[model samples]
Target: MSSYSGNVETGGAPDVRNLPGLRITKLSVGPMDNNAYLLECLSNEDLLLIDAANEAPRLLELVGDRALSTVVTTHQHMDHWVALEEVVAATGARALAHPDDAEGLPISTSPVVDGDRIPIGDCELEVIHLVGHTPGSIALVYRDPKGTPHLFTGDSLFPGGVGNTHDDPEAFASLIGDIETKLFGALPDETWFYPGHGKDSTLGAERPSVPEWRARGW
Candidate 1:
């Protein structure tokens, strides 16, 4: 197994313990630097994987001795699920994704919609459907016992700007709107969001740039 560090070359494995009962492990894989996450609910050791982009062996090793309960695909993009089939087959975990992108997946997916609650041991992950990046790109929000929020965003909202809309005006508008209202407007500033690739960011850090992003029409 590769060493557990935040560096991608060393598997980008982070030392668990971002929140009280949440242990987050990140791995950067594939040529695109796709990020795959292992969310361990420490209370009962229940595990939920967000994106299975690549490197099945390393992902499996990250699971260690715990049974992987669910694997949630953030979107239907091939880069985000390159290792989906192998990981699911190895773990026997149910695959969950939005219905819009479910058909693009190689394996059967238990469809998820907005306002759905996915249980992870004592914690519950609230599904927030955000469009524009993809027809069904979704984000998972988990509120710790102390009220701090943790978000798992696929390709929708990133650290700098919203996910690529391919330069379409409407798509860009929709994406920014969803993020502004659903994420920024609703969640607190301290919410830490983990995207499908690259570094994580908090609402407070990125909140000020919303208007600028909208004005630039990106």
Candidate 2:
């Protein structure tokens, strides 16, 4: 009964029924080309906007008149929340982020801790706190009804490698450990992940290189 055509970036119509009513729209915005995702639950018309990183106008347009249930900031980094305030103001959505990085965010955000459950209609996403990218960097995991799992790992995990540690030894160690245990060890290889920016990758593809990454000490 909903008429949302989605945005031009989504490319062709997403088969809602086949996808179990889960719709993911990725928009490249801001100076950093940060990816802003619109996760829409077609069954209940529940929308969760992830990382309002920029291009406020386009983000607003994608959101249209639908009420947004939550606006989630994956971390406290400035680039990730450039449009956070504006989008939240426009949509009246609750701003949610990890407590470790909440103070750094431009707007006040409700703290989401590890093991918290975020509901999207009948489905839900489990929060995994990935440190080192930031003290509060977190990833949201959604297990598809059909079996495959989906991960939204802000900047913590990405294709080819983990997020930049900026030469911080302690931070790098923490992030690598978390990625090894929480991400690679916990999730299945076929799990598909959408990062905060850039291309998507699967755990199956990146799992083999874990030793290489550790050897390089990056």
Candidate 3:
């Protein structure tokens, strides 16, 4: 596998990671600098996109001539799906999102709850529902048999803290609590996590800050 920094800039080249059986491409788009991820199964070339964000043309170009199997929206936030309808229309890919945030999307989406597995050629991504960022925000977990786990956390988890809860203590508590138990508590320290925006981070790098994040209440 090549060294992937997971660093991307809007209108620039995407950072690609070649894993054992899958390839991950990360791109930054829109004014919000939302990060969109493309996962391709090496065996069959099955493609899955996480978050359309913006710049439909660029996302479509990223897919090239290949068909996109699915597009999974992490949350109901507007910035995350600005290109969703266009991309899905262009690729004829199935749209998937959590039920609570499904109505916020431009098009109809198949609801996926926690524990649901989304197939991508020979590999699959497991769903992990995380609340607070939105009524139904989710993360995707890809457990590579030959390597450590990978997570797509959307706006739920970031390098320094969880997603914004609008200063609502209740919401922040819920998000942090779920992240601690479901993410930090369950996944290994080596697990690499890609967020909806900005840079990527490993679980081990952020584990020690969980207490601080909770205390800060962001």
Per-prediction TM-score: 0.93, 0.91, 0.99
Model 1 sits at a Cα RMSD from the real structure of 3.0
Clashing pairs in 3: none
The count of residue-pair clashes in candidate 1 stands at: 0
Per-residue lDDT over 44-72 for candidate 3, one digit per residue giving the tens place of the 0 to 100 score: 99999999999999999999999899999
Lowest-scoring 10 consecutive residues by lDDT in candidate 1? 2-11
lDDT of 3 at 90: 93
Candidate 1: tens digits of C-alpha lDDT, residues 1-218: 53334445334544454667777887888678888888888899999999998888888998887899999999999998888999999989999999999988989999999999998888889999998999999999998887589898889988899999999999999999999999999999999888888878899999999999999998
- Local distance difference test, each candidate: 0.88, 0.84, 0.96
Evaluated against the true structure, the overall lDDT of model 2 is 0.84
lDDT of 2 at 166: 89
Off by over 4 Å in 2: 1-18
Q: What does the lDDT read for residue 16 in candidate 3?
A: 97
Between 1 and 3, whose TM-score is larger? 3
TM-score sort, best first: 3, 1, 2
Please state the error at residue 184 of candidate 2 in Å. 0.7
